[model samples]
Target: MIAKLQIQLNTALYLRDPQSTDLGQKIVQEGIYMIDEIGFESFTFKKLSKRINSTEASIYRYFENKHRLLVYLIAWYWNYVEYKITFETHNISNAEEKLKIAIQLITSKLADDDNFPGISESVLQRIVISESDKTYLTKNVDQINREGLFKGYKSLCMTIASYMLEINPAFKFSRSLTSTCLEAAHQQIFFAEHLPRLTDIKKEEKMYDRNCEFLTSLIFSSLKS
Candidate 1:
């Protein structure tokens, strides 16, 4: 049997823990679907409340505003990914193979897992790829960063960077390389679907496989250089 997983996020990201209560869980579960369906800009408390048959005030009880909620969602995604990376690489003794697994996890397609009942990873991944950048691009980013809101993302990068350093002890830009590849993976995926001209991935080909191949090549080449 697949074990259920809980992704603990920073407290500052939300007013109340959305995973704590039934109503709160509904907020997160429905919020993910609503944001993915209508997008973050069009997403509002009124819409979310109506979808969940709750009041806007009730939704606000769990989250400060839509932006905070978005950050919470993004942060949750990073934490989940980090957990996967840790679990998938825990037994591997080979550094190169471990790094390869991390790359594939980052670049591959996401699907709904029964282990996480309320959250749809496949749908959340779409929000992550498309709307995640909006969370930290605001002017108050420094304030939120001070609150440890970006810890999950930073932790994920650090985990991947560790693998890089394991493979090449002398590599100087492990963190930089990890962050760049992470962003590049998201950008390439977005470009392939929306701005095809911006990426080399063909529409007819398997996107995840092609993307994983490209990233593995890039990471190994850079580490070897």
Candidate 2:
């Protein structure tokens, strides 16, 4: 097997770097599996320790709290998505086409990435769709934002928003539309799956395609002069 990928994260997210040691790496690898299997709300250091055959204190040495660990995972995901978008769009010249491709990439079903062996991007995508909001919905979000824990997500939005501006210089809501499209892409799919009444997408249709279509329509419509 290929060596596991290591993407350096913000130091503030952890008390110790989890990528540096075997147990630390296991903390991250199993953390992703456990979080995906259960969820951030249901996940706990005590439970994680039991699953990993480690102590809660050991987990604490890597992360101060479960919330911080969730943020770390989400941030890693945002960075990975941004990298994929940038890589895919680097050679594409048309701004409108680029945005469409970006939307498709953002909304489409995620595949497991080989570059990052320990974490499953598909599961991470589901987590982002389902639980990413919890990362910043807390009272301490302002403090964490100041610490740059959310920079990866913000950077992704900013980059995509820039694409909108290039397509329509007169459009004033590029950033707003960018963020809305990104969030709505996942949220609408979530709604379609469990709360079908909340979405216009029918249950019978290919859900990912419809979500992508909706976002593509929304973004282009908002950008057209």
Candidate 3:
């Protein structure tokens, strides 16, 4: 069932902009593939263009530079996750259920067979860990609270935090904890992939499920505490 859903999701994403198809999406996808195969430092637009059957000029038409393209790809993943969660669990009444559903959605998407096949574990780690720094340096801001990718992430965190507050008004932590939970999950997933020897579990699905369980437990425990 999960495999089938993943296939459908990938097909839908590929078919999203049939009319006036922007060649940029192909460039971005190839760039992501190159980053997955080689580290970001080793990745170049020339290599990406060669892989995508396009010229450097065509790639630049979509992105100013490789850095901006990376940021956009990361933002794209975040937006995709947000859209899936909003669609799947938006109407659930119980905050606890909503939280669980959110975790499940994330894990399922990450573990999906049709997920961005070229993205490597290290690239994902870099994106999650360096999101704040990247955004700050790129935008020359102290923090990201307004618009764009960071704002989208912030909105998701606040939405989850609000649901948590509804479940337990006494829960004192700010919405930042939601962000922390997200980071923790990303770290766990990365660790499971890149450092499996250090981890007891070997299976990606097990690691994903464990992380989801831990995150859900943390939220619910905090509510009770």
Candidate 4:
């Protein structure tokens, strides 16, 4: 069992910090569960308020809107991912091995961690796989980014990109490569379940195992060039 995880995100993500109060935490916990149960396109704060038995006004106090709430949840997940990566790889001195460990952490099947009793990491992982793109695929992305809405994602990506450089100092496009690895980890699992035609993984092989193999080959091959 993982110990209690305390990930502090940027204050800009919320109007009222959810971790500061019980009602606020309920909004976040239920929001994650509902978004995963339904889909982001159909999620609303009204529905979320109903789930937590709080008025819409109460939820609005915590978040400007459900979109910000979603961003908050996504940010928290990325923070958790960074925490896991550090925990799993910090002791390893080998860059190749560190990169491999990082890939494994990102691609592995997510299991619930009791440490975070509010949000279900397993369910949140599903939301990330499906709804994460929505967080940035908007016309106001620049404005949102200017407000540091994507700091969590960007921070984690930079950490991984740094690992990429450790493995291949001469290789350019480390950031692109790092981002691609993150996207591929989510996209391939999504494609395997919903759009099998897009991926080459065999039916008998677990998606995580296949991705680990493919990414290992891809990362190593690129570094050798």
Candidate 5:
């Protein structure tokens, strides 16, 4: 039912929208897999070009560099999550319930959404969990922020923070709490899978459920305090 939703993004993110044409779409579809297979530091456009059977010049036509492409994918993910939050919680009246649902969506393991035909959200979520910080951790983050490249992330945080205020208007750290929960969900999941000693949660088939419970408790308890 949510297939037709359009995710508007910052124009500065790409030289051309990768969703616009077949070659562009192939670049994105394969790029996600390539990035997931190889770490982002090793993910060069040359490798991507070889994988997609497209020339580097052609790939560069859609993106100024691989960093921009990474940002584009990150932005797409943020917008997609925001779309899901709005869709799933629209009918619920209770603020606490809405926030709870939002927590589940953000913290749980992602599955491929049939609505987005070519994109694998399950794989994309791993990118977001592992590589999202790279998008803004650079020295040029200030310049890129001014270009509105991070608006998707900022908007998603704002949406969640609004729910926080609904439950507790006096909570002064809604934005901080929202951003922390978002990062924590990803960090805890990563730690569970790769570095077990760093997190209390055990790695298992349902590890994400433990991560969700941890964040939900952290958020609600902090709000109640």
Candidate 6:
């Protein structure tokens, strides 16, 4: 998670408009697309400049370096996710519906064709696995943590727990279960890589839909006394 944290930290640096110019916004948008395509290791200012029809100097004028550009991209992704989730699921009234809608929204978003393809499993493992040892390299660790990804995750869990509670206030909503749900949402995308033995279900979009359906059923059924 260290590398992931570092990337998140770096991405945060570009959250604002440095010059309020059209070029700056374009740089941010195109940079995200490029990073999603090529990834942080292979992505460079020159490549981004070429992709966006801008000069390397122009990119530098907004971002200090490639790492900073990446930080911005990560931030943008999270911010977009937060907005999407809030807007899509906020209208549901019941806890069960809220939890179900939240999970559906999360799964749907991850399944989106436009999500950053540059973030491969190897890269994610490198970030999470190496987090402790490489913490110092990421200057924006505190800031990224403060950005509320984790908090947002916890809130989702609380929402789920609230729904579960509605069924039976005694139901134990352990941290493990919350983490399981969160990981399950992510696993829906990379299940082929993460759980190869679990059947190549993700290759079929129908399977994802079925899985979501089954997941909600299981959660609701399990909550019943």
Which runs in model 4 stand beyond 4 Å of their true positions? 1-3, 202-205
Candidate 2, residues 1-225, lDDT tens digits: the string is 777666767888889998778898889888888988998879999999999999999999999999998999999988888888988999999988888888989888899988787788888888888888899899988999999999888899999998998988888988888888878978898898789889998765488999888988888888875
RMSD of 3: 6.1
* Candidate models: Cα lDDT each: 0.91, 0.87, 0.60, 0.87, 0.91, 0.55
Global CA lDDT of candidate 3, please? Answer: 0.60
lDDT of 6 by residue, 1-225 (tens): 123121222333654454256787677656656655665668798998998888989888888777655545444443444455566667766776666775575445353223333333333332222221232257776765675424444555665566567657777753455556555654544554466577444556465565566567657666673
Model 1 reaches what TM-score against the true structure?
0.97
Q: Please give the distance, in angstroms, between residue 215's alpha carbon in candidate 4 and its true position after superposition.
A: 1.6
For model 3, give the 10-residue run with minimal summed lDDT.
Answer: 4-13
Poorly placed runs, candidate 1 (over 4 Å): none
Q: What RMSD does each model have against the real structure?
A: 1.1, 1.6, 6.1, 1.6, 1.4, 8.4
lDDT head-to-head 5 vs 6, winner: 5
The C-alpha TM-scores of every prediction are 0.97, 0.94, 0.74, 0.95, 0.96, 0.61
Residue-level lDDT for 199 in candidate 6: 44
lDDT of candidate 1 over 44-113, digit per residue (tens): 9999999999999999999989999999989988898888988998999999999999999998888887
TM-score of 5: 0.96
Tell me the number of clashing residue pairs for each predicted model. 0, 0, 0, 0, 0, 10
* Weakest 10 consecutive residues of candidate 2 by summed lDDT: 1-10
lDDT for 196 in candidate 5 is: 89
How well does candidate 3 score on lDDT at residue 74? Answer: 59
lDDT of candidate 4 over 1-225, digit per residue (tens): 567657899999999998988998888888988999889889998888788888999999999988888889989988899989999988889888888888888888789888887778999999988888888888989999999988988898998888889978989988888889888888888888888899986545487899878887887788888
**Candidate 6 TM-score, true structure as reference:** 0.61
After TM-score superposition, the amount by which residue 120's alpha carbon in candidate 4 deviates from its true location, in angstroms, is 0.7
